[model samples]
Target: MGPDTRARATSESPAGREQGQEYDASPYLPRRGGLAALRRASADCRGCPLFQDATQTVFGTGSPTARLFLVGEQPGDQEDRQGEPFVGPAGRLLRRALAEAGLGDEEVYVTNAVKHFKFTTAPRGKRRIHKAPSLREMSACRPWLAAELRLVSPRLVVVLGGTAGKALLGNSFRVGEERGILRPMPSLEEGEGEGGGLLLATVHPSAVLRADDREAAFRGLVADLSVAASALD
Candidate 1:
């Protein structure tokens, strides 16, 4: 691949991950609205072929009245079977940490950039292991994510990782550089859902779960989340 096609890399805690390179979820459909109907309507999503392998499309969870919305990259192994976002091991870590960060899972609406489970089938002695999604994959799933954003219209949106960051902020988003930075939720404002919505970026709890020093990475994750917690203060 050309250098221009290279994955943007970062120096985080995830040991086995191709550090510095945040994978893209999709590229084809960029629309960020009309999900409630589209999800109800389409039996098949031509936007991306990811739906073919996934069990079912996992949509966002929480109340329309929630003040905060947290977005992650995509679903993981356990989440795939559950048909909900953030139900996997990583999600459990997030749930605990987010609570310490000053919010409960119920207080924040949670979702993924892509609603489906995307992984490479591995021959684990007759089983499969999980892998990350590609940029094109993330892009294809963007439309559904956009749809969730419109429906929830959270007052604060926390991007849990790069995929969530790129989907809303653009390709050059760097969590290390921009963590704790909250920007106006332009789309929410434009749609009249909520005013003063803030968008912040942070390391996904999953990233910390994969870290060499899990405790340290989690602490950092919590510190960033503390900023999120303080958004209400």
Candidate 2:
């Protein structure tokens, strides 16, 4: 990572104030290793309070040479328990969507903006309801995602949902406004120049599952993903 990128990763955000001290995963990142080293190091991360409650840190998974990258908001109930990103119902939906969009499973790398699962317990059952990570939390955990970006260096990044979008593109990102448009990826200082690669934003698969018109929502997701597929051609 370049000095500027490193500086952003270590910088304090609001979550730091809430914790009464600065917090970020940057400190735990391996200064001299690849994805394997990063995954091992992340297991011990105490960068944010979310780790205190999460079962484990879910790191990105795929070959380093994958041409496509997919970033989601964070882990859901099933994903947290499984120690992998996108393994729940939403993940299943995503996999199907990718197939429909003509992107093979082996072509993509999958991960999340935040590695930990943030949630609140249900009052009646032992169920853990999903809670969206605050921007502060997203900022705190960004270095891991940044590192993944540096390593995978995919030709196109499909950002699923607003959280992942904001993590990559900043606060102004909106899925409704940005979905399906291919544009230059912002420089992460490790891969791709200013005009290299492309980023496309879309709603989270969970949102499609939650929609009243499930089929329509799923089709919309497929449509957006097809745009990404076309770009690779």
Candidates in order have lDDT scores of 0.69, 0.86
Against the true structure, whose lDDT is highest? 2
Worst 10 residues of 2 by lDDT: 6-15
Prediction-by-prediction clash tally: 17, 0
lDDT of 1 by residue, 1-233 (tens): 23332221111212114533333332223344354554553333434545656666777777766788889988887887877788878888988888888776447778888777778776566344666766766765665676666676677888998888887776788888988777776452234543447888999888898899999999888888888888866
Best by TM-score: 2
List, residue by residue over 1-233, the lDDT tens digit for candidate 2: 35554334334433333536655778788998899999999987768778767888899998788889999999999999999989899999999999999886547899999999999999998999999998878988999998998888899999999999999988999899999999999975546567358999999999999999999999999999999989988
Give the range of the ten consecutive residues with the poorest summed lDDT in model 1. Answer: 7-16
- For each candidate, what TM-score against the reference? 0.76, 0.89
Q: State how far residue 30 of model 1 sits from its true place (Å).
A: 16
